[model samples]
Target: MPELLSPRIDAISFRQLRLFESVGRLCSVRRGSEECNLSQPAVTQSLAKLEQMIGVELFERRPSGSYLTPLGRILYSRVVRMLKQMVTALFELEVPGGQVGAEAIVHRLTRSQVRSLVAIIEHGTFAAAAAALQITEGSLQRAARDLECNLRKNILFRSADGVIVTPAGIACGRRMSLALQEIDWAINEIDVARDIGESRIVIGALPFGGSVLLASMLDEFLATQSKVDVRIATESTSEMMQLLRDGKVDLVIGLTQETVGDDLVSQTLAETPYEVVARRGHPLTGQSHVNHEDLIKYDWVVGMPNSNRRNCFDRLFIDGPKPRTPIATSALLFIRHLLAGSNRLTLMTSYELQHETMLVRVPIDVPLPCPTIGITTRADWLPTALHRDFINLIKSRVNTRSIMGVTRTAA
Candidate 1:
C-alpha cells in the first residue's frame, strides 16, 4: 500500500493553497497575482514552497500560462468543497455562554495559516477566500504559518499532487467550522441576554431572488418588522442551498421545487415560464410567423449548460439544420446584456424580463416550459420564529401573477 502522504509533510499554510488555487484557476501568473494582490515574485515563491512541501508539480507552467495537471484538478475539486463548508461554518451561531475551551494541541501553525486554512476550507480556494476576506495572498500565507506554530501541528498537507487535510487536519477543520458557528451563536445570544431585540436574519437566494417577485415581499417585511435585521445573499443555486443547509444563513429563497434532495423540505411560491426575448427594436421582435431558422440567424446568448432556460432553448432550437449555438453561456445578467445590445435572442424567466426595461418578449408560437421557484429548508432543522415569519411573508406577497401563464401560483 502506498503510504498516505500524512506524517512526513511539515505544514503548508492555507495561503499557499490559495496561491495554488489562483494559479490553477486563472492559468496565468500575472493574472493570478493581480487577483490575489501579491507581488509576482511573492506569489511565485509561495507556489514554489507549496509545491516543494507537497513534492509534486501541480501545474504545467509554460511561457504562455499555467495549466492544472491531472492531480491538480482532483485537488482543486476537493478544495472547492472544503471552502464551501468553511464559509458556511463562519456564519453559524453558538450557544449563549462563556467562551468554549481552547484545547492546546501540538501542531506547527501560525494565526495567518489558521485563518487562511479556515477561509480556504470555507470559501473554496485562495483566490475566492482572499476575495471574500479582502486580504493579500502573501499576508494570508504568513498568517497560515503563524497558525501552524500556535497549533503545534502541520494542519495542511501539501504535495505535488495537491494539498489535503490529514486525518488530524480534517478533525481540526471540523472543529473550526463548528466552533466558529458556536461563536457566532454565542454573540447573538449575548445580545438577547442583554435585553437587546436586535435579531438579524440572513436569507440566501438564487439569482432570481432579488427580482420583483421576491423583492416586494422583502420590502413589505421591512416596513412592518423594522426592528428585525435582514441581510440578503445572492449566489448560484448550489451555493445558496449549500449555505442554507450549513446554517450559514437563516433561509434560502428561490427555485426549490423538484431539485432539492430527500433531506430538504421545499415550499412552492410561484410558477415561472421561459420567454424568448430580444432587444427592444430588433427586426424580429413583432413577427408572428417566425421559425427556428429565422431565430438562428441572429447571434445568441444562452444560460449556462444544465440550467432550465438553457435546456429549454436547446430543445426549442434543435429541429433546424443548424441549431442556435450560444456565442456565450452564463448567468441571467450576461444573457440580458447580450440581448439588450446586439441582434441576439435568448430565453428569460418572466420575472427577469419584468426587471429589464430594454428587453421585449419575442412570442414563440410553440410551447416554452415553465419552472417553479420557491424556498427550501433542511428537513432535520426547524426555522426560528423570525425565519418562519419571513417565510410566511414570502408566501403572502408572491400572489401577484397579474400576468398570464408567465406567472402562476406554485406550492
Candidate 2:
C-alpha cells in the first residue's frame, strides 16, 4: 500500500494513464498510437515504463497483437473511470463567464499542492502538517504559496497563534480534497475489482441515524458484502458537515436541517420524533404528562451544547429559566449508562430506546417539532457503483412515513 501511494507512483502523468487506457481499449500498441496521435515506438516505450514503475506485467505481447493480463484488465477499468472523472472535474472547474485565467489556474494546480493545503488545514499548523507529509516546512509553504498565486486568492493569513484559513481558502481546500478522494476511490475500486483487498466507506453517523437506520443496515450489508469495509463516526452535525466538505466522510446519515448549503444535497428518508426517556423504574416513567417543571427538578443529561438535540431541549424551557445540564455529551452509550444508574432525564428518538431494556421512554407529550432524518452528501460527489448500491439499501430500510404526519418521497 505504501509503495502504491508513494510520490514516485503518483508522479505517473495523466498522459501516461491515457495512453495505457487507449492501448488496453484498442488491444494493440499500433492502433492505440494511431488513436492517441503518438508514434508506435513512443507508445511502446511509455507502456513499458508504466509497467516497470508499477512492477506488473500489464500486457502480454504476441506477434498478432497485445492483450491485457489479469492485472492489466483491473487497472484499465480504473484508469478509464479515473480519466473520466478528471475530465468531469475540469469541466466543473471551468468558469461559466469564459475566464481563461481560471482554466489556466486549474491546470497549474498539482495534486501535491492541493494535498499540502488540505494537510495544513487538517493538522492546524504548517510544521505539523509538514511532519505528517514527511516534507520540509519550506516545501509545504512553497506549495501553499504557489497554490495561492495560481488561484489569485489569499488562502491563509498568519496570526500570533497560528495560520488562519480564509473562507475562500476553506472552499478551495474542500474542492481539492474532494478531487483527491475521487482519485483514491478509483484506486480502491480497482483493488476491490481485482479482489486484492476490501474497499472502505467512511460514514459520519449522527446520533439518531447511527442508533436507528445504520444500526439495522450495517450488519446485513457487511455480512453480504465481505469485500467492503464500513467505518462509522458519531459526531456533531457541524463536525460531520466539515468532514463531508473535506471528503473525509463519504456521506452523513442523520437528521436533515431545514436549510442546507448549496454545496450539499440531502435526501429525507423519514421523519423522526424526539421522546423523553429515563430509567424503567424511575418516577417519571409512569407519568401520564410530564411538564418541563417536573423534569427540571432532577439533573439532566443532554446532547452537546449547540447541537440540534440541545437546541430542542433548550426550547422546552423557552418561557422559563433554562435547566441545569449537569452532564452534557453526545455519546448515546454513555447517556444510557448515566440514566440507568441515576435518576436523570434525557431526550432521544424512539428508535434509540427500542432495544435498550434499562431505559424507557417517558410518556410526556413534548410539543417540539420532529426533524427529518436521512442522508447528506456533497452535491458534486460522484459515488462509485458500490456506494450507490449501499445508499439504495439504506433507503429501502427506512420507513417512508414522515414524523410530521405526511407521506413524503425519500428524495
| Cα-based lDDT at residue 105, candidate 2 | 55
lDDT to native, each model: 0.61, 0.73
Q: For residues 199-266, could you state the per-residue lDDT of candidate 2 as single tens digits?
A: 67888888754546788788878876877667887777788888887677888988886666998999
For every model in order, what is the number of clashing pairs?
Answer: 40, 1
Worst 10 residues of 2 by lDDT: 402-411
Q: Candidate 1, 129: how far from true, in Å?
A: 13
lDDT of each residue in 327-354, candidate 1, tens digit only: 6454667766777678887777776666
After superposing candidate 1 on the true structure, give the runs of residues whose Cα lies further than 4 Å from its correct spot. 1-197, 319-333, 403-411
